[model samples]
Target: MSSQFLVTSRRDMEERGWDQLDFVYINGDAYVDHPSFAAAVIGRVLESRGYRVGIISQPDWHSAEPFKALGRPRLAALITAGNLDSMLNEKTAAKKFRSRDNYSPGGETGRRPERATIVYANRMREAYKDVPIIIGGIEASLRRFAHYDYWSNKVRHSILLDSKADILSYGMGERSVAEIADALAEGKTTAEMYDIRGICYVTSRAPLSDKAVMCPSYEEVRDDKKAFAEAFKIQYEEQDPYHGRTIIQPSENRFVVQTPPALPLTTEEMDAIYELPFQRRWHPMYDEAGGVPALQEVQFSLTSQRGCFGHCHFCAITSHQGRIIQHRSHESLLREAKRMTELPDFKGYIHDVGGPTANFRHEACGKQRISGACRNRHCIGSEVCPNLDTSHEDYRRLLREIRQVPGVKKVFVRSGLRYDYVLADHNKKFVEELCQYHVSGQLKVAPEHVVKHVTDLMGKADAQAFLKFKEWFDEANRKLGKKQYLVPYFMSSHPGCTLRDAVELAEFLRDMHMQPEQVQDFIPTPGSLSTAMYYTGMNPLTGEKVYVARRPEEKQMQRALMQYKNPANYDIVYKALCQAGRRDLIGFGPKCLIPPRRLKGTRPEQTPQRRGSLQLPKKTRRRDTRGRK
Candidate 1:
């Protein structure tokens, strides 16, 4: 309530040692790690039950220093979230681009720690073998099964077993973290805590054999890395919950992990979660290197809601968060907004709010409450429950409230908004408001592909809907007397796209007179429905045959479609046309506007006699020029 935890000083921890610590929380990634905030919340929860607590932020879990720093105390347990290190490459030009103005005098330097949450857990295990290490967050939640790793380009098992954490909390952490802390403080042992929902833990006999007791097979998740990464990118771009079975296993050697039921938060609960104290500063390291750039300013972010009803095949939100829409209260959002406004040299705007699908206010229809997402693994042919509502009213209201907060001036919906939902609204007032107020002349919307077959395969909205939405968006901006432009996000080389599809898309771009600023190659992220199609060429849900373009040439064509303006793409486009047997498109296709080349003369025509005869042409030319002069 005080927001004092927003600024964690070393002295605060020094004053509160092992005796004051009811639980020691750990973070896998520094970006998501908010020791000060976690400590304050867990400590408050513990204190509510008459126990004291302290927090340790990104401590050297590998060394005994952290353990010694706290000394020997009534150590209740160790809590952790998904990230151990920032998954972003600190040395990347992307990072530099994101923080151009914030560039330090020395330029951006310093290596980010390994981002795998399990890495930090393993280090913690090394120091405190018997201590309970509870893991949660995106890294732990999504990886709680056999998953494909983009960084390593291989399938791996759940972080729980890999890191040897006592328990793995999946999905949203607020309730689960509190429950786990309360259970541990009551003297429940690690083995006894398995009964808690949204957690994954090993049985006592887990390590006795090489096999996992409850693991899914590794063959299930032996997906291709490229497909996995592409699907993952789509999920992030769409921000719609994907509705298909994820690869839960890779090989017989390792078992795949599945999550417990998704817990949808009510507005009240969402309010309480956001109200938790968050460290509202750019990460110290990031700041020291020069503050984060405007684009990368959201190095630390929090979502105000979860679950999406939009059943996009390329998204994992529905699978991970369910089709139910949950939200935090307006009061809670304002509180966080105020905290963000209070940062040192803080500007008025916060990065983003909302989750899964930003515009999703509730389930599609009117199902108030229901069981967690049906873990059916596929939604290809399944009927969408009528109760789910994909309306934008609630979000519109939330955004309106967020914008009016005292210190906040601009509230960007950096999260993906379901364009279908926005377009379906009978009135265009909301769209106009978004254009005039929230957007900064550039609004990002995902129209993953122009190919109808592929969009159907990926469970995305048809291209027509995107076009209609584009029209309405433009109209809305015009009505509001604004010059905002739509930056449509497109994906190339998805699971079921072919060279023809890519070519058609290229033609569409040419017709629209639009060129994309960024093009994302499909990378299959682990644990999503789309990944299965990318890997097996079959939809996991319906077992239906799906076309996948995997050849190097096909991939090149799809990629070239997004870069029509680049000269390098000329050869690529040519080869694509040739390979697709569209030789007519070689010189100047409908989409490609290059000029044709002249034909060459045969060798016989260039002999000495032919040359002498042709010499007359030169004499005629000279005579004509002399006469004219």
Candidate 2:
């Protein structure tokens, strides 16, 4: 383990000649000093600015005593719910408790309490009422507004108010966090730090500026679906950092003010952030409990970029990281690769060099920085934006440089790719090189759904785009004499998807002779356009009604349709087909999805087999023998 790991104990602080620290970072995950972990990134960012920061990871939330492990900080304490929302980390799409947690030590669950930000905040307040609490990370960032909560089946107020934290920092919070720390150091109160962008706070009075947009209040939206939909539309459109307005929402006795998003860091600034001295490993104290499971994949991988322009409706990346794409320079990435090689357990492989969309290293257009992402339109829609830059030359160059790094034998680009953008690119060389060098036999692309209505609701290109990309991918691999395949990820039970739509997707898969092993069931997580639609049954943008699958059985049936080959899902698939009026598809013909029922006298074991086609014996024919009959 690297000795450069962050201090987790008071003894380590004393060894460094420090009796007290400036900021103590309370994290929901077990300590892992890797950049991919938000806890480590924020800690390192503060350390780079000459602040003494100690980390306390996954402390006991039962009492205030555990939160006081690091004692009182000279300044304030920063908190995060690790890399994912606590509810998301602990529960599955089906709302069942997950037995293993990737962010916890030894893949153990129950290490952190549910609604961890709220839980930790309460404990911290109990321990020291005067210490200002600044909460960020995925949980607090997405829930910063009054949004839908699928777990509880209702609308909830801003996490900032719910947790009663002094300030809530949203998005990739490097710049805003610095402003916060500086203000606290200057003896400024949280109330005085109102001008900082990318943060939300409670104020007794209204925002002084008339430019602020007052969305539906907590009371109005919680009770009225129309008000909720309108508020969500306003929130979705104003995500741009430049053109966005200061949004205020009234709560019971006060108001919550959210400033415009923070501007993205420049290339040089992005480089400096990633090049910070990080141990890139879980703390050795976790060595006994085996290491934090989340670090294993990212310890060797590099996050060359942050933020996504795709803005998929189901994803929280846009709300948490903001829209504009930010990336590191080639030189900085190469430096990180060299350091990875120096580790004792280092293999010759570099697992991934991608972010939300691996191939989208450049912004959609040059005007993004000058103005902002378009107000109500998607950068990608029915047609690729004419102004969109589809060139992959920069990405190609970056990959070439990393492959030449000494001791790095193989490099993989395992992150999700926007096939729509790739298909739009005129250059075939990037595609060819990717098939030959970067891929280890399979490349993952997300088409989400096949039906136009469903894909439109998902903010994805239509299925034809994926088909064309697959054609090009096959051609590229053929030219290189390689046998690479594409794994297309699909989802079920999103806002606009109904039983009919799921059956359409299942039939599409059947025609393609593909039965996917895993299917993604959409969970209406906070701060997403799809979640608003799920809760209100209306498209926030257009005010048109949308079909929502809120029942547990319906959602399960939709998921089962995608993996219809599984015998355990047979009953659900049959019920789904019958419900969708697709019983015509339930035969042993060439296009049949399943075999006919047991014929009233067949053996008990006569069930559909999980084979290439999942088809059982075809009914024998008295067929076409009309003349003989």
Q: Each candidate's TM vs. the true structure? A: 0.76, 0.94
Clash pairs (backbone) in predicted model 2 = none
Candidate 2 structure lDDT: 0.84
Decoy 2 TM-score against native: 0.94
lDDT measured at residue 583 in model 1 versus the true structure, 0 to 100: 65
| The 10-residue segment with the lowest total lDDT in model 2 | 620-629
Flag regions of model 2 displaced more than 4 Å.
598-629
lDDT at 376 for candidate 1? Answer: 40
Alpha carbon lDDT at 202, candidate 1: 50
State which candidate has the highest TM-score: 2
Name the runs in model 1 displaced over 4 angstroms.
1-3, 6-11, 17-20, 31-115, 150-153, 204-216, 219-259, 283-287, 291-296, 299-303, 335-353, 371-390, 405-411, 551-553, 588-590, 593-629
lDDT of each: 0.54, 0.84
Backbone N/Cα/C clashes per model: 43, 0
